[model samples]
Target chain A: MTNAQGADKPLVLVVDDYQDAREMYAEYLEFSGFRVAQAQNGAEALEKAFALLPDVILMDLSLPIIDGWEATRRLKSDERTRAIPVVALTGHAMAGQATGDQQVSCDAFVIKPCLPDALVAEVRRVLAARKASAAR
Target chain B: MPSTAPLTPPAAPGSEARTESEPLSADRERALLWRLVDAVTDPCFFTGLEGRLLIANASARQLFVADEASNAGRRRAVELNQRLLDTALASLATGGASAVRRRDLSLVDPVEGTDLLFELVSTPVQEPGCTPGVVCVLRNMTDLGRATRALGESYRRLRASEQQARSERLRLDLILDSVADPILLTDPAGGTVLMNDPAERLFAAPHDSGEATRRRARTNDAHLSSFLSHLLSPGNARRWRGELPLVEPGTGAPMPMEAVASKVLSDQGETISIVTLLHDRTEALEKARLLEQLRAASNKLEAKVHAATAELAEQNEKLRRQAFQLEQASAAKSQFLANMSHEFRTPLNAILGYTNMLLQGVSGEMTPQQRRNLQRIDSNGRHLLQVINEILDITRIEAGRMPLNAADFELPELLQEVMAEMDPIVARTKLAVHTALAPQLPPVHGDRQKVKQIVLNLLSNALKFTHEGSVQVSADSAPATSTVSISVKDTGIGIAAEHLEKIFEDFQQVDSSPTRAYGGTGLGLSICRRLATMMGGSVAVQSTPGQGSTFTLHLPRRMRQA
Candidate 1:
């Protein structure tokens, strides 16, 4: 969660209201060689994200106040935070599609508790894409 | 008559008085005769053979001439006198000349009109060598005649009164006969004194012979004996009601009757008669029998109705129990589906994640064939995961537990993205794709994820269900009402009428042929509908059986300006 965490070995923030999910995602991210930060809700995630400024955020859409949709908007709108990528986490895949359909800006949608490797790959891809944009 | 003591009768031994009274003084003889006549209460009279009045005492003159002057001019009196005189003369001419005669002797007095009496003792008197002289003596016996007349009048009145009483009895008997009901009257001793013809007929017998009547009378008397006994028990004055059986004299058959009796009394308070009335009870008995039958039938019907109601209640109870069991089973199935989805996905997440990490060389490098094989494994796994996800989505929706993440999101942006995503698929099918986004659309409060799922599912359906026709995605917003409608219209193989409703059901496809040229779990539309609802919106589809299909999503827009 510190700025020293490189873009390739980026720090990843995992936000979910479910305790099991937060643990699961943190384990998966750590195994994938990314420094992992975990929050139980959008509010916690926002506070943590400021301190961490992680490369990518994996946010559960159903989180309490400052849900994934609003959190993504806030992150995208901030100058210091605009470069970070946000991906949606959901239980029902159909519901995840609905979030994309409403144009609540997020880099991608993934159903939870998703396969660890698929989630890590998404994290690494988005981080690499952000690093490429930042180099530009 | 100084010489009366000097001479006695010449031939008389016990004739002293005769000799002493010989040549007696005329004054003395005349005095003796007068004394004898005056001594009798009856008026005395003597008559000569020539029927001339010879001698009469003062009594005779008073009685005989009592009405002679007073009744002389009356015709009835004269006739009465002549009849009296003829009867007296006729009696005297008979050889014995002794008879009792009753005659109406007239008296001319207004107070005493006539007189009648019985006369007796008339004898003839004769002298030597001289014609016999007839002498008649009269006696007044009018008082005896008056007594006889009074006795005769009393006997006649008694006979007339008896006749009137008998006739009155006959009148009552006739009245009793005219009525249909039997009637009888009993004597104070409870013996049958009078019975009407109906009563006689009811207990039938011959009526002609007096002997037979007497015999019947005895039998009736015997039956009445008990009645009298009951009445004598200080209950005679009280109205006695009872059932009695009168047997026919000849047939010996019982005639049942309901009887009511009362005691009739004379002025002296002595019971003169016991009167009874009878009513036949056959009809009443028959009516009672019929009523009993009707009551039994009604009771049977009531039992049947009760049984039918019991059966209906039992059936209803069974139906309710079945419905409750189905609901419980359905709920359990939904819970199982949700739990399985979460559990299954948890492990699958690791498999897919590890694969992705390997493919991206986050772990290490891999050969070209290994990478290609890994890609295939990932692709196929992804496809299988999509199917599993669809199954979970359909189950959750059916269980009514799908969550909605509502917020303010742009409908136009959502629509444009859907069209853009569907454009590649449309290009592959060589079909034209079109878009219409309403100008300056308002944001809507909805679950963005669910809304996007609906749009993606609908746009995919348009591309998949169509072969070569154009696909159109349209968006319109009501600025005044803050509502947005998004639609995907396609010139595709339209749904059959029967399949339109079926298409929205989980895992339901139009046909079951595996080679039917379409591949799916048939859960796309169902998921789309559920997602739309979760976003506080709805999804509807219209299709002609042979034309194309249009799917529309409606959402309530949020007032971003407000």
Candidate 2:
């Protein structure tokens, strides 16, 4: 259901290497009543994330140029996009887990081949958690 | 006073008829005496007390005469006769009561021209009142004197030889006693005829003790019997030597003795006695025994070393083979994982993602039939991805490359989470899902994600198999044993008794036929079992033919902390 957000729709940046996955994520987010922008690789994702200052970022960790891990690090470090939440999307099952000494900086993780509705639901949950923490 | 009785009346050479009563004048008497002296075989003469030759018989004159013409031509005969008359007169003067004397005289006979040995006798002669005269008689004795001298020489030589033989016997006795080795000389009958000082000491008993002597004798007797038996054997060599055991007589200790026996032969080539020399061999035998033992020990050590070396070589070969096999299996596993991730999962992700978008109405407007078809495509794609993931999980476990990310998580919470995840599938089925959780259950210590996966797989299996009956899950912790058990029970088409164990094998399904109703890659139970094992837990099943099956996962309360 595409609710009528008018001009106040929250923008979401979708990053993935595969064009079909990126297009599908963009179409689903648009139809779900959100303004969506897409990047084919992590470098473009970082550019778009900073330029758009999206409310939430959907990141595919296996991106080309700069991987999602580095892009997420850059986005979180910059004050302009630091407030935006990142939800990691990856084909690797354990990519979301903290690896070695570095914690997974993203706010959420979803395995690839995930249901569209389920990915959308996770995105909304992370945005709400971020809002709650900010209010606290 | 002068006695006129004549000792014997002289017989005249011409008169054969003058009887013993006939008296004759001095001249006739003198002539008769001269004829008598001349007729005697011995040479005889008559000398006056003044040492003058008064008369000489024809025998004496014949002994002195070389030739009748030479006698008258040489006056040397008269001088020799006068010297003989003086010696006779000296002998008569020195005469004792019988007025007779004898002496040995050597003379050269002028007639034979050789030295002569003679014994001369002088007898006193008395005339009616005239001076005394001597009658000298001379006898030949050359052969008798030579025989007497030869007899005295033989007597002296015999005495010297006898003394030499006595000393030789004494020297031989000293030599025999000086030897240290026991030597025994035995008669042919094997009696102890003679023994040296050493042998005597070897065989001697305690002196003055009769019993000791008897004991010594008995021991010696035994030794003697053995010795004789060997020596008296018919074909024994003339000289033989060997070792023999004997008991020491005084000490009664056993002794190893070496005896060398030789047959003593007489001049006639007959066996006289046996001479045996004995030496002690106790030390030598002991040395030989030690040497033999050392050789055996060294041989055993060598054999053990050889066996150990062979075993080590075999172990090294086995390790090499195992290492090679491990290398090959690891390479195959890595290649498979790479292919699954790139060649299979990537495309499968696109399929599921696109189908998900279509079902979500991201692709234009869709009719009811299009929605149903898209849902089918979405579900099927998810199913295929699950199968690929299961295969990869089992392959990683088998290759021992599946690293466990262990953490502490409550079992009840994990179970509820898994149940919530399975809600959609369970809602589609008629079977009701239930839970039996022990209160205040302890947290399980294992790989949280893998444990969650295991529980989800079990619950999914339960929902998939059950048609009408309920699926029950139970979890309990046993603090005493530090273990926890989670059970999943389903009342559906149950597995046969025989297939219970086979179900957990790779790609094995209860109904394995191509046309079988169940849809699966048949690697679910295999992955569950492998994951449980990796978490130091085990998966077991209990089932009846048409009733139900209960699959349980038992894990230690605390895993080894990494």
Candidate 3:
């Protein structure tokens, strides 16, 4: 997606292996007043996150190469993108355990097939929590 | 015939050697008789009836004369002559009127060491004018008498030995007769010398076929001869055992028999005879046949058992392989379903996401018809996603891959949470929702999220089926039972009694109509029961037709670990 709105809107980089799920989530995030960018895999996600320096990351866990957890680890380790919040999105029913057990260090874990409203509300909640922590 | 010279009186030498005092009488006939008597081999002498010594023959001179060739001979003869004459005259003094006389006498002479025995024969004769005279002849019997004693002793011994032999034969006959087996004694030429009663019965059995053929074979004696003659040859072994079939008396059946032939040998090592004993073998042969048959049957049974065991092992191995293959195939199917379940959500997310946007008015002003259609699409998409989730859950449980995130939580609080989650459905249907949970419900250890899922499904099902009547959510726990029961009662159209159990199966409903009218994949109750069971709990239902059903989720206070 192209960033057509003001820079004040929190930018969310939506990464997923499925182009449609990625586009759908990005459209809803954009409609929710956040600027949305997209990548089809974790490797593309890493490149875009570095270039865009987005305020938040919506990551789909089951990606082709460099899965969401590895990309999140890379983003957290890199000084340039270490501050970005990575919210995990995946269709795995048991990924809830990954978030609870701190397997991925994601800001929040959202099972896929959730409503657009729920997905959008999660992104805003993660962005606000990241901002609140950063301010502290 | 040996002779001594003339004997004389003891004073003959002193008398000038004239023997005229004892001359044969003046009768000529008497003299002639004396000369004949002198020529005899035996000793002859004559004595007168008047008791006088008249004359003696040449052999008689042995008693009275020594021929005067040696001094000791002459002296010994002289001494014995006088005594012999005197003794003789005394013996002739008896009364015999001169017929003829014989006597036996013994004498010990003064000149000899041993007694001499003699037989004296005398004849009295009257010769013309002389008085009657007697002439005597003497024979020495020493050798003849000794030989007679020896003959008599030998004859006595012969009689004793013959008596002993007869008794021994009698004893042997009794022994052989008393035995039960047939016994026969045969000569060296195979002739029957002796036979006992049993043998007599054996051989004397009327001439049957065996005897005829056997007797014809021998070209000699008939039934009385030995049947073991083949072994009874003169030089065959002393003891021989063999089978020789003899006929039973009168019946004439070929009886199985064993005959032992023994040879009797002489001290010179000659085969004197053969003794054969026969034994009947009817019972022994019958027993042997039975034993052979039993052995055959035993071998057959063992073979059958071995074959059956081998077959069972083969079948067991085949079944084991089939079971292993089935397990492998089932594992592959579960793996496939899990992968597909994960893949399905990506598209399901798009369906639900886009539909949420259209119904949310993010895709601007739509017609009323279009809005209504979008709501249906959104609901169906949600239903499809629920079905997928249920299938994925069941498959995971079946594969034993579902992990429980168990924790301790208040059962009443869990019930309130499930009520809140089903509020949206209860609102749309205008169904009265109520909760009747015990205030002092105990805490439970379980997977909270799956419990929520099951509780939500139960509440959802209650709201979906009940159109207007109240749906009650009630929970109660019994500390004694260590269980907690959560029941969702709905006043909807109930299930028939027969369909109560059927409804809980995977992808089953009371009927096809309810599945279509209420819109469900029919997997909800199955997934609920499986999840409950996974946490060591269960789901049960009670219902009657036209009166709504109450489905209860019974959970343990503590989850049981594998």
Candidate 4:
């Protein structure tokens, strides 16, 4: 799995509308030995998802122009992006009800304003599950 | 014999003169006396001793005659003459005057049917050398009686006219007294002649002046006095007007009076009196004051209402600005959470992914402990990712930013998927998971994904809360009302009644326990309710403190899509 660059750090995509939050998440992810890129909205997230094909996507539910719900649907629907595991990052606790069979196109759901340990834990679990499936 | 002159005929024959008497025979003397008596214009006669009319003058003859006939009879004259001669002879013998007066002597003419009024004057002529003769004069006095009667009637009529004039004056006085308006009269010479009781009282006078020479003046009778002064001024004989405020002596309330005066002219073109009419303006004054007060009050009320409206407008503007700010803040918070999650997950993904690849010996085989250490890293990384997902979900739900995708789908199939998803967890915990869908239940038309998410969340909550108990999922149809209800119940640590309502609020749980035991964002129920409401539905929980808890999702058969 190591690339030509020795000790290849995992790359992450941060999608949010606020600059402060993007910088904050970038700081945390970088310190954790990962390469990070930021998208302010869902449309940017979609664009970067294709160009970078990052290890995982951190999707924000509320975004300008195209929200996370539609962006997730498009990502899961496309053949190229469908295999990439998508997880929802939302501040609103109200997303639980909206995560129905037809609505939750992503692999998993998460809440925002979370503890750092919880945040790191969820990101690790979904990635591990993806690697296991790929090895199989 | 101052001059020896002969007096033959008089200068005028009607003016005759007589000498001293000449002696003659008795018959001649009596004839002469009768002729002299006939010269009288009154009725005269001579009667015999036995009451025969021996002689009579032309007036006496005419008196005895009936109509134009002369010498018609002597019987009636003889009776009248006998009474007159007897009265005259008796008066001469008794030494009374030689003339006797007899009135009311009734004499009937021989031919005339009625009697005539007569005055008989009898005189005895006992002259020397003349026979003893009786003279009787009779005159008609009916004309005199009528003249006296006419004079007496005129006197009585004059008295009655004076009485009528006095009574009319008294009646006029009584009428003026009974009236309320003051009334007064002045003479042509500008003297006060009459005044009524009201005039006296109005002027504060003790007595009303009668229509006479004497009159008492009142202190406040200035209007009348001024009117009379103006009329007698000889220059301005026209009408005059004056106004004054009259104060009530008892109550001290001032009354406004308007007085108008006009000259009363006589037929001779002389001004006699001036009548001044007074009108009270108290009611008119009071009405004007009340109108002013009402206008002032209306203006104040209108001003107050305008101020209140202005204040309300300002408050409404402030509330609108506040609402806009809150909306912006919420949107930014949601964006921040989403961005953080995306950025965090990517790097974490690489770590967990590389660890798994190393454990599988993708490039080289690893030792047992190394593999175990890599597995730990992978598992911990996965747990971190799970927490990240829960945090993002809760943030979206709290900010009311959760997305709901609505579409038509078979509700039973979706429920089966939910059971399939929860089966592994239930099997690991060794808890029974049971489900039932109402027969012939209408397919719910709502956010299909959101509905599934709600069912899954409710199922996970049930499984997590329970230790080794049954978790049941059931659906019921109320087709009559076009709605479906899904319920998930678990025999777990129950919620209290009070906490039941608060448990659906964002970031709130029945108890502040860590998520490791009953792993959730504490926002699951809140998000479920919000999403349900977005699809025109609602979520409610029924629980007992010790028994168990049941979460129900009631949704419409058809709803407005997001």
**TM-scores computed on chain B for all candidates:** 0.56, 0.48, 0.60, 0.63
Where model 1 places Cα greater than 4 Å from the true spot, the runs are A1-111, A115-136, B1-184, B188-202, B205-237, B242-259, B264-324, B363-376, B405-410, B420-427, B437-449, B476-485, B527-540, B553-562
lDDT of 4 at B63: 50
B1-562, model 1: which lDDT tens digit per residue?
A: 0112111112222323556636856655655566567566665655556544455565544443333345554445444443465456665566453443333333332235654464544556677885465544555556767788888988888889888888887887789898777777777654577778877665435666455554654565456455556765654455677776555444444445677877787898777777777777666756887888888898899889888889888988888898888888998887777667776776566567667667867667999999999999887777778887888877777776666655777877776776677666666788888888868777777677777788888888788888877888888987676678888899888988778889888777787577877777888988887676665567888998657999898776742210
CAPRI quality level assigned to candidate 2 from its DockQ score: acceptable
Best candidate (score: TM-score): 3
Q: Lowest summed lDDT over 10 consecutive residues: which window, candidate 1 chain B?
A: B1-10
**lDDT at residue B516 of model 2 (Cα atoms):** 89
Local lDDT at B322 for model 4: 81
Query: What is the lDDT, from 0 to 100, of the residue B518 in candidate 2?
Result: 82
Off by over 4 Å in 3: A2-4, A65-84, A92-102, A105-108, A128-136, B1-205, B208-296, B512-518
Residue A68 lDDT (model 1): 76
Q: What DockQ results for candidate 3?
A: 0.58
What 10-residue stretch in candidate 4 chain B is worst by lDDT? B1-10
What tens digits encode model 4's per-residue C-alpha lDDT throughout B1-562? 0111111111232323344585655655555565566677777766543344556676776554323333535455644544554564455446656356464555554445345556666666667786566666777665565677898899888889889889988998898888766666766566667767765555553333442211223324554566457666777847767665654433446666666667788898777676656656677778888988998999999999999888888888888888888888877877778777766765665565456445655547888898888888877887688667767767776676666666788788999898888776677897888998778877776778889989998998888888877889999988787888999999989898888889888778766766445545687787788888888889988998677999999888898643
Ranking by TM-score: 3, 4, 1, 2
Greater TM-score among 2 and 4 belongs to 4
- Give the winner by lDDT: 1 or 2: 2
Q: List-wise, what DockQ does each model earn?
A: 0.21, 0.28, 0.58, 0.07
